[model samples]
Target: MGRKKTLTCRRWDCEEAPFLGGLCEAHHEEDRLKQLARRAAIDALSTSCIAGKLPEKPGLKDELLRVIRWWDKACLAVNAGRQDNVLLDETQYAPEWCIAFADAIIQEEMNFRQGLDDDATVAFLKKDTWTRFEHLEAGFMSNGVKRPGC
Candidate 1:
Protein backbone atom coordinates (compact mmCIF):
# COMPACT_ATOMS: atom_id res chain seq x y z
CA MET A 1 0.00 0.00 0.00
CA GLY A 2 1.15 3.52 -0.69
CA ARG A 3 1.91 5.75 2.29
CA LYS A 4 -0.44 8.63 2.82
CA LYS A 5 1.16 12.04 2.85
CA THR A 6 1.32 13.93 6.12
CA LEU A 7 -1.01 16.93 6.25
CA THR A 8 1.63 19.42 7.15
CA CYS A 9 2.41 22.82 5.74
CA ARG A 10 3.70 22.43 2.20
CA ARG A 11 6.38 25.02 2.69
CA TRP A 12 9.90 23.97 3.52
CA ASP A 13 10.91 23.44 7.20
CA CYS A 14 7.39 24.06 8.50
CA GLU A 15 5.86 21.14 10.37
CA GLU A 16 2.64 22.85 11.34
CA ALA A 17 -0.56 21.18 10.23
CA PRO A 18 -2.26 22.52 7.17
CA PHE A 19 -4.68 25.40 7.62
CA LEU A 20 -5.62 25.74 3.94
CA GLY A 21 -4.32 24.69 0.57
CA GLY A 22 -1.71 22.40 2.13
CA LEU A 23 -0.07 25.14 4.14
CA CYS A 24 -0.19 26.43 7.69
CA GLU A 25 -2.10 29.67 8.30
CA ALA A 26 0.98 31.91 8.31
CA HIS A 27 2.51 30.15 5.36
CA HIS A 28 -0.77 30.21 3.50
CA GLU A 29 -0.90 33.96 3.83
CA GLU A 30 2.72 34.30 2.83
CA ASP A 31 2.15 32.07 -0.13
CA ARG A 32 -0.74 34.20 -1.19
CA LEU A 33 1.38 37.33 -0.95
CA LYS A 34 4.26 35.73 -2.78
CA GLN A 35 1.95 34.81 -5.61
CA LEU A 36 0.72 38.34 -5.77
CA ALA A 37 4.27 39.68 -5.74
CA ARG A 38 5.25 37.34 -8.53
CA ARG A 39 2.31 38.34 -10.65
CA ALA A 40 3.11 41.98 -10.14
CA ALA A 41 6.69 41.37 -11.10
CA ILE A 42 5.74 39.58 -14.27
CA ASP A 43 3.28 42.25 -15.22
CA ALA A 44 5.75 45.05 -14.64
CA LEU A 45 8.68 43.31 -16.21
CA SER A 46 6.76 42.28 -19.27
CA THR A 47 4.82 45.43 -19.97
CA SER A 48 6.07 48.43 -18.05
CA CYS A 49 9.50 47.96 -16.55
CA ILE A 50 12.18 49.73 -18.49
CA ALA A 51 14.13 47.32 -20.64
CA GLY A 52 17.86 47.00 -20.05
CA LYS A 53 20.48 45.93 -22.50
CA LEU A 54 22.44 42.81 -21.62
CA PRO A 55 26.13 42.98 -22.27
CA GLU A 56 27.77 40.30 -24.41
CA LYS A 57 29.36 38.98 -21.22
CA PRO A 58 26.72 39.86 -18.67
CA GLY A 59 27.04 38.64 -15.09
CA LEU A 60 24.47 37.99 -12.38
CA LYS A 61 25.09 41.49 -11.07
CA ASP A 62 24.16 42.98 -14.41
CA GLU A 63 20.90 41.08 -14.61
CA LEU A 64 20.09 41.99 -11.01
CA LEU A 65 20.77 45.67 -11.49
CA ARG A 66 18.70 45.74 -14.65
CA VAL A 67 15.50 44.82 -12.85
CA ILE A 68 16.07 45.62 -9.18
CA ARG A 69 14.26 48.93 -9.35
CA TRP A 70 11.28 47.43 -11.10
CA TRP A 71 11.22 44.56 -8.62
CA ASP A 72 11.17 46.96 -5.69
CA LYS A 73 8.35 48.96 -7.19
CA ALA A 74 6.32 45.85 -7.88
CA CYS A 75 6.85 44.57 -4.34
CA LEU A 76 5.56 47.79 -2.83
CA ALA A 77 2.48 47.75 -5.03
CA VAL A 78 1.69 44.11 -4.38
CA ASN A 79 2.24 44.11 -0.61
CA ALA A 80 0.62 47.43 0.12
CA GLY A 81 -2.67 46.06 1.40
CA ARG A 82 -1.14 43.53 3.75
CA GLN A 83 -1.18 44.92 7.26
CA ASP A 84 1.35 42.39 8.45
CA ASN A 85 4.88 41.76 7.25
CA VAL A 86 5.63 43.77 4.16
CA LEU A 87 8.84 41.92 3.58
CA LEU A 88 8.90 38.15 3.21
CA ASP A 89 12.06 38.27 5.33
CA GLU A 90 12.44 39.96 8.72
CA THR A 91 15.59 41.66 7.41
CA GLN A 92 13.58 43.84 5.00
CA TYR A 93 14.07 41.74 1.88
CA ALA A 94 11.42 42.29 -0.75
CA PRO A 95 9.78 39.10 -1.97
CA GLU A 96 10.60 40.06 -5.53
CA TRP A 97 14.21 40.41 -4.48
CA CYS A 98 14.12 36.96 -2.99
CA ILE A 99 12.73 35.50 -6.20
CA ALA A 100 15.33 37.14 -8.42
CA PHE A 101 18.18 36.31 -6.06
CA ALA A 102 17.09 32.70 -5.98
CA ASP A 103 16.97 32.68 -9.77
CA ALA A 104 20.52 33.99 -9.89
CA ILE A 105 21.69 31.23 -7.57
CA ILE A 106 19.87 28.57 -9.54
CA GLN A 107 21.34 29.79 -12.80
CA GLU A 108 24.80 29.71 -11.29
CA GLU A 109 24.23 26.18 -10.04
CA MET A 110 23.07 25.04 -13.45
CA ASN A 111 26.07 26.63 -15.06
CA PHE A 112 28.38 24.92 -12.59
CA ARG A 113 26.68 21.57 -13.04
CA GLN A 114 27.14 21.81 -16.80
CA GLY A 115 30.88 22.40 -16.28
CA LEU A 116 30.47 26.01 -17.42
CA ASP A 117 32.01 28.04 -14.63
CA ASP A 118 32.05 31.78 -15.22
CA ASP A 119 32.09 35.23 -13.64
CA ALA A 120 28.34 34.98 -13.05
CA THR A 121 28.80 32.87 -9.91
CA VAL A 122 31.24 35.34 -8.44
CA ALA A 123 28.94 38.22 -9.37
CA PHE A 124 26.08 36.66 -7.46
CA LEU A 125 28.21 36.59 -4.29
CA LYS A 126 29.19 40.25 -4.41
CA LYS A 127 28.43 42.50 -1.44
CA ASP A 128 26.97 45.27 -3.56
CA THR A 129 23.72 43.49 -4.23
CA TRP A 130 21.59 46.35 -2.92
CA THR A 131 23.62 49.13 -4.50
CA ARG A 132 20.61 50.79 -6.10
CA PHE A 133 18.25 50.27 -3.18
CA GLU A 134 19.18 53.42 -1.34
CA HIS A 135 18.60 55.58 -4.37
CA LEU A 136 15.20 54.05 -4.95
CA GLU A 137 14.40 54.37 -1.26
CA ALA A 138 15.29 58.02 -1.29
CA GLY A 139 13.07 58.72 -4.28
CA PHE A 140 10.15 56.81 -2.80
CA MET A 141 10.59 58.45 0.60
CA SER A 142 10.85 61.92 -0.87
CA ASN A 143 7.62 61.28 -2.71
CA GLY A 144 5.93 60.08 0.52
CA VAL A 145 5.37 56.61 -0.84
CA LYS A 146 4.79 53.84 1.66
CA ARG A 147 7.73 51.50 1.19
CA PRO A 148 7.33 48.06 2.71
CA GLY A 149 9.86 45.55 4.03
CA CYS A 150 11.72 47.30 6.80
Candidate 2:
Protein backbone atom coordinates (compact mmCIF):
# COMPACT_ATOMS: atom_id res chain seq x y z
CA MET A 1 0.00 0.00 0.00
CA GLY A 2 1.20 3.52 -0.87
CA ARG A 3 1.48 6.21 1.79
CA LYS A 4 -0.98 9.05 1.35
CA LYS A 5 0.34 12.62 1.33
CA THR A 6 -0.87 14.97 4.06
CA LEU A 7 -2.64 18.04 2.72
CA THR A 8 -1.67 21.29 4.44
CA CYS A 9 -3.90 24.31 5.01
CA ARG A 10 -3.50 26.65 2.02
CA ARG A 11 -3.79 29.92 3.93
CA TRP A 12 -0.83 32.18 4.54
CA ASP A 13 1.42 31.09 7.44
CA CYS A 14 -0.92 28.25 8.32
CA GLU A 15 0.54 24.79 7.93
CA GLU A 16 -2.25 22.88 9.65
CA ALA A 17 -4.15 20.11 7.95
CA PRO A 18 -7.13 21.12 5.87
CA PHE A 19 -10.41 21.20 7.79
CA LEU A 20 -12.89 22.49 5.21
CA GLY A 21 -12.60 24.18 1.83
CA GLY A 22 -8.80 23.76 1.85
CA LEU A 23 -8.39 25.87 4.99
CA CYS A 24 -7.79 24.90 8.60
CA GLU A 25 -10.62 24.98 11.14
CA ALA A 26 -9.69 28.44 12.40
CA HIS A 27 -9.20 29.91 8.94
CA HIS A 28 -12.39 28.38 7.67
CA GLU A 29 -14.28 29.93 10.56
CA GLU A 30 -12.66 33.28 9.91
CA ASP A 31 -13.58 33.12 6.24
CA ARG A 32 -17.11 32.09 7.11
CA LEU A 33 -17.55 35.06 9.43
CA LYS A 34 -16.11 37.39 6.83
CA GLN A 35 -18.57 36.07 4.26
CA LEU A 36 -21.45 36.71 6.64
CA ALA A 37 -20.34 40.26 7.44
CA ARG A 38 -19.73 41.11 3.81
CA ARG A 39 -22.93 43.15 3.48
CA ALA A 40 -22.41 45.45 6.49
CA ALA A 41 -18.80 45.82 5.49
CA ILE A 42 -20.22 47.98 2.72
CA ASP A 43 -22.33 50.58 4.45
CA ALA A 44 -23.17 52.26 1.14
CA LEU A 45 -23.01 51.45 -2.51
CA SER A 46 -22.53 53.45 -5.72
CA THR A 47 -21.49 52.70 -9.24
CA SER A 48 -19.49 55.89 -9.54
CA CYS A 49 -18.20 58.45 -7.04
CA ILE A 50 -17.88 61.89 -8.62
CA ALA A 51 -15.59 63.22 -5.84
CA GLY A 52 -16.16 66.54 -7.56
CA LYS A 53 -13.56 69.22 -6.85
CA LEU A 54 -13.39 70.39 -3.25
CA PRO A 55 -14.59 73.88 -2.34
CA GLU A 56 -12.38 76.45 -0.52
CA LYS A 57 -14.23 76.91 2.75
CA PRO A 58 -11.99 76.48 5.79
CA GLY A 59 -14.22 73.96 7.52
CA LEU A 60 -15.00 72.07 4.34
CA LYS A 61 -11.36 72.01 3.28
CA ASP A 62 -10.16 70.87 6.67
CA GLU A 63 -12.73 68.08 6.79
CA LEU A 64 -12.32 67.07 3.17
CA LEU A 65 -8.60 66.75 3.70
CA ARG A 66 -9.25 64.06 6.29
CA VAL A 67 -11.63 62.27 3.93
CA ILE A 68 -9.13 62.46 1.10
CA ARG A 69 -6.38 61.04 3.28
CA TRP A 70 -8.61 58.13 4.31
CA TRP A 71 -9.71 57.23 0.78
CA ASP A 72 -6.18 57.49 -0.52
CA LYS A 73 -4.76 55.07 2.05
CA ALA A 74 -7.73 52.74 1.80
CA CYS A 75 -7.47 52.51 -1.98
CA LEU A 76 -3.77 51.79 -1.70
CA ALA A 77 -4.43 49.11 0.89
CA VAL A 78 -7.08 47.45 -1.30
CA ASN A 79 -4.68 47.43 -4.25
CA ALA A 80 -2.04 45.79 -2.09
CA GLY A 81 -4.45 42.97 -1.06
CA ARG A 82 -5.05 44.61 2.30
CA GLN A 83 -8.78 45.22 2.01
CA ASP A 84 -9.08 45.17 5.78
CA ASN A 85 -9.41 48.93 5.54
CA VAL A 86 -12.78 50.67 5.14
CA LEU A 87 -12.37 51.05 1.36
CA LEU A 88 -14.41 48.85 -0.92
CA ASP A 89 -13.01 45.40 -1.38
CA GLU A 90 -12.05 43.89 -4.74
CA THR A 91 -15.35 42.00 -4.81
CA GLN A 92 -17.37 45.18 -4.22
CA TYR A 93 -15.74 47.91 -6.34
CA ALA A 94 -13.95 47.91 -9.68
CA PRO A 95 -10.28 48.82 -10.00
CA GLU A 96 -11.18 51.72 -12.29
CA TRP A 97 -13.55 53.10 -9.65
CA CYS A 98 -10.90 52.83 -6.95
CA ILE A 99 -8.24 54.56 -9.01
CA ALA A 100 -10.66 57.26 -10.11
CA PHE A 101 -11.66 58.06 -6.53
CA ALA A 102 -8.03 58.07 -5.40
CA ASP A 103 -7.05 60.49 -8.15
CA ALA A 104 -9.92 62.83 -7.36
CA ILE A 105 -9.11 62.89 -3.65
CA ILE A 106 -5.41 63.52 -4.26
CA GLN A 107 -6.24 66.44 -6.54
CA GLU A 108 -8.74 67.75 -4.00
CA GLU A 109 -6.09 67.67 -1.26
CA MET A 110 -3.71 69.56 -3.50
CA ASN A 111 -6.37 72.16 -4.20
CA PHE A 112 -6.95 72.65 -0.49
CA ARG A 113 -3.27 73.13 0.29
CA GLN A 114 -1.93 74.75 -2.89
CA GLY A 115 -2.89 78.32 -1.92
CA LEU A 116 -1.83 78.17 1.75
CA ASP A 117 1.16 80.43 2.49
CA ASP A 118 2.03 78.74 5.80
CA ASP A 119 5.19 76.64 5.70
CA ALA A 120 3.83 74.08 8.22
CA THR A 121 0.77 73.44 6.08
CA VAL A 122 2.88 73.09 2.95
CA ALA A 123 5.40 70.77 4.58
CA PHE A 124 2.66 68.67 6.15
CA LEU A 125 0.74 68.44 2.89
CA LYS A 126 3.87 67.35 1.06
CA LYS A 127 5.11 64.85 3.61
CA ASP A 128 2.97 63.84 6.58
CA THR A 129 -0.40 64.04 4.90
CA TRP A 130 -1.24 60.55 6.13
CA THR A 131 -0.80 61.62 9.73
CA ARG A 132 -3.57 64.19 9.45
CA PHE A 133 -6.26 61.63 8.85
CA GLU A 134 -5.98 60.06 12.29
CA HIS A 135 -4.95 62.84 14.67
CA LEU A 136 -5.89 65.98 12.71
CA GLU A 137 -2.26 67.12 12.67
CA ALA A 138 -1.02 70.31 10.96
CA GLY A 139 -4.62 71.55 10.50
CA PHE A 140 -7.39 72.41 12.88
CA MET A 141 -10.70 70.57 12.78
CA SER A 142 -13.45 73.13 13.00
CA ASN A 143 -16.47 73.00 15.29
CA GLY A 144 -20.13 72.97 14.15
CA VAL A 145 -19.03 70.51 11.49
CA LYS A 146 -21.87 69.46 9.27
CA ARG A 147 -21.29 67.29 6.21
CA PRO A 148 -23.60 65.10 4.18
CA GLY A 149 -21.95 62.00 5.61
CA CYS A 150 -22.59 62.95 9.23
Model 2 — which ten-residue stretch has the worst lDDT?
40-49
Task: Give the RMSD in angstroms, all C-alphas superposed, for model 2.
Answer: 17.3
Q: Which 10 consecutive residues of model 1 have the lowest summed lDDT?
A: 83-92
Q: Write the per-residue lDDT of candidate 2 for residues 59-118, one digit (tens) a residue.
A: 544543444555456556766766533332331343333333334334444555676343
Error of 1 at 124 (Å): 8.6
Model 1: per-residue Cα lDDT over 22-76, one tens digit each: 9899999998987875664454344332123222233544554455554555456
lDDT of residue 63 for candidate 1:
57
How far out, in Å, is residue 126 in model 2? 20
**lDDT of the candidates, in the order given:** 0.50, 0.45
On lDDT, the candidate that comes out on top is 1
Candidate 2, which segments miss by more than 4 Å at Cα?
1-5, 43-150
